[model samples]
Target: MGNRILIVDDEWNMRNLIKIYLSREAFQLNEAKDGYEAIEMADQYAFDLVVLDVMLPDIDGWEVCSTIRKTSEIPILMLTARDDVKDRVLGLNIGADDYLIKPFAPEELVARVKALLRRRKKDNREIDKLLITFNDLSIDYDSRETWVKGTRVELTPKEFDILYTVAHNPKTVFTRDILLDKIWYSEEFRDLRAVDTHVKNLREKVRKAGLSFNPVKTVWGVGYKFNRPEDQY
Candidate 1:
């Protein structure tokens, strides 16, 4: 079966246009007209990607994206009439994978969708052989699971990817741009602050899980790295 994609937009013409283009590319498509329907449908189905519009009737796209980021890592491409930089940065920080302004070419949208799906597949392949353990931290790439102090830790998809990447490359500093390129390769307009936001969220979750030490550390005037306790000692 081809990749399943959900298109969420209040405009019938927009949905139809996206369906027409994506259907030609062999993607299985579904449509939702509102944010509420979008969230409900997402919970009920396993969609590979969501093409979401920012201005929804009920819940806005940013809220929907944030809500989804709490549980799933399904890629999201945000559509908006507003092309403001802050709006784009806000969407990215809230977990939208990619953003497209309205009045966009359908061809460009299709290309972005293809690139996101392709990057997702590549990321999966790269993590297939990974199983990293350091002190109380444990990550199993095959299962997409993480544990701290022998207790399971819940992480969003991006959180897990960032943690796993840094953990695997212990002691190696990764700049914000580097991490963005490595993880969100298809998003060319992402904010560097998004990296800091995810790291902060990841650390808070770990701390809330009763872990005393944070494995991810900041390198002064540089970026971040994962340092094993033994290595630091």
Candidate 2:
């Protein structure tokens, strides 16, 4: 009836303390003493979230997160010491959905967990599954998969979002400003670069798929446009 959470820590007391604190919140909680146990439990159980400690006996949280990411996008929340900002960033870069420093309040943990799950659910709801085809490249939104003439293409979430936006409405020119508003929450000009980067990355991925065709075209100083095969100059 509640969200399932796996708390992985070498210290059993720490795990138990957190479990007691979280129990009132009605989360279906589980625990693992180390990364090895975490992985084994994860492989055997379907947990909605994982709260992973950075320091583990058999394996560290970073490796655990990376290993899990190779197979699943299930949300991961890493635990790092207060002084380890680099560790926090590393966790994020390595596929952790979020991170909390040591000695964090139980209530803050609850809030962060709730916020992450809320955002993920909102994102999932916005995804409309459609099988879009242009030339040899076809995108299936339902499975979150893309293909070029039968070859699969891997895309990050942002890259996929950018491609989906433009490809959904072919031939429409979306200015950097407009795209920034559409793809990112910030209206700042600095965020415009992110849109450009995602587009660039998307194009490169398409190129890697052995397709000579580029669906997205820059509109000089104006914006970017999704060019259908027949519409390209």
Candidate 2 lDDT tens digits, 1-233: 99899999999888998898878889999999999889888888988889899999988999999988888788998888766677778889999998888889989988888887787777665653377888897888778788888998999977887777788878688998887777676654456677888889999999988876888889899988887877766
TM-score of each: 0.58, 0.56
User: How would you encode candidate 1's per-residue C-alpha lDDT over 48-165 as one tens digit per residue?
Assistant: 9999999999989999999888889999999999989999999999999999998998799999999999988987667554878777778998788989888999998878988989
Model 1, CA-based lDDT: 0.90
TM-score of 2: 0.56
Best by TM-score: 1
Which residue segments of model 1 deviate by more than 4 Å?
A: 132-233
lDDT of 2: 0.85
- Candidate 2 off by > 4 Å: 128-233
Error of 1 at 104 (Å): 1.1
